[model samples]
Target: MRIGLFPSANYSAKKDIGPMKQMGDSHVISDVLALGKGVAGSQQVLCLDGASILLRKLSLDSISKVEYENNHFCFGVHFLLEGNYSFVSTESKSRLNITSGSYNLVQWPKTNGVEKLKGREYTSIEVFFTQEFLEDLLGTEYNSAFEKFDNTLVDKPKYLWNEMKPIPGRLRLLLLDILHCSYTGIARTNFIESQIRCLLIEVFLGKENGMEQIGGEATLSTLDKEAIDEVVSYIKQNLKRKLTIKELSEVAGFNTTKLKSCFKKVHQTTIFKFITQLRMEKARLLVLEENYTVAQASYEVGYSNPQHFTVAFKKTMGYLPSLLLTNLS
Candidate 1:
């Protein structure tokens, strides 16, 4: 199941490579592709009709490197859930450091790069789409919304590369859901395809809403920046407590108005929104990763009523907490 571009010499000889021949679709075939020997952990590869999604939670005990040379023209979005890696591009002589809490979108071209994975555990999701599939999905006006790479297309770049953007709150939740999904057979296929469609929409259309351009005239002083960072740390540490802007302002040593404006300027989101995002993220992690009951998680995150918590969780995460529990069970 090796893709022609990413060749590996470390495949287990005992594993049956011929199983890939029985895979009926391209998505399934791509999912089973050998990722080399350094990855050891749970993996789920879903081959949808239009796209292929690979979710891996693995440990890299040794340095793993992959080099590509002018391979297929496809669009890929890689989500780095945990761990860090560095990429050195031979073509541009550029180095990109991909860290946890960030995602990278690239229009892979005829280029060469070395990916150096540190010896640690990593969780990641990668979605790949062919040119025809993307063209069909994006339609004629794609050029206006997406910038090209390397002048590949006559009209514009067929794909766009967005390096190291913070994952939006909803998209993060969706990725968690995909990772925890328990369905199988046709239900699993349909669920994955739907998730991929939503993910693509979030990446293409929802970029502007989540990404803040941090340059130009608006800037924060070093003292103010440190204050905002402290406030963020405080909020995360005290999620169970009822947080108010006034209390946060006191911590930052600023008035309420200045506190709100400065916090938004530094974090690219308002204080309340940031707090809510953190609370929801923590609550979900507790329920899904730590096996906390719904009521316990809700109360731990400062919800007085379970019903109220359910409403807020559904609104913020686009699904009920019970769904996560059900998948976990």
Candidate 2:
């Protein structure tokens, strides 16, 4: 593998490492650069048995516009993994924005983009399969799973507040197992393929619905759609300020209950959850990218309580904002 260290950053790759395996074990893994202006970061990309997983460590200030290669399907499994990234469509440059606070399975469209990485530190797992490889596995029923995965594309997919729940836990363990097997030098086989099938079954069968199901519906008219959009847009724009449902209701000209239901249908989350996530994302951006103090950043994001924000930050990002800032700095 050719490892390139560019003018802005340094990278090193070797076949032997202490805690991780090198990329390309029956799959392809690339060294990803931390993009966006603000903090220095590192990314670990691993090719598990039949899947690819990326672990990225970063400070809060990293947010960059990134482009990915074609022909891969990825599942974002971490807290806010599904919620925050913007996946740009190569064909039309149309973007699919994954809002914060959800789990996601992303299918990369068959298009290419300029190879520059800028954004927050994040790790993602991807499964790449050629048409032939998929056909062999799908036989006659391949389309079914594909359709279900596609349905999720229309909007974000729900995950329980925590992944330890039965359905999500099993899938996560299965993924981790695949990673272990690949790292330990397991050969690709039907057994490995079957495991993937089982994982997909669990994902498609779960009662977890898409963002559209929770946020918006067909019975709602165009005006209703417009109203919901306005309220959501307001919330997004004012993440730094204090916002209440009563305030949002006035903006949308709908009662609190109607507003809440509308948000669930279009965004797949309660208004309160959406705001909490917005605050979390804001705090993350401030502490990691802007280099704000924990106290300063906490308040800027609407967490009047620093202790509460610290706990929430650690819970969502899997690391303390202070620690992340130290690494990036």
Best by TM-score: 1
Model 2 TM-score, all chains together: 0.47
lDDT of 1 by residue, 152-179 (tens): 6322112243435555556776787776
Which window of ten consecutive residues has the lowest lDDT sum in model 2? Answer: 2-11
- Model-by-model lDDT, in order? 0.66, 0.50
Candidate 2 residue runs with Cα over 4 Å from true position: 1-205, 210-219, 311-329
**C-alpha lDDT (0 to 100) for residue 137 of candidate 1:** 72
Candidate 1 weakest lDDT stretch, 10 residues: 1-10
Top-lDDT candidate index: 1
**How displaced is residue 169 in candidate 1, in Å?**
2.6
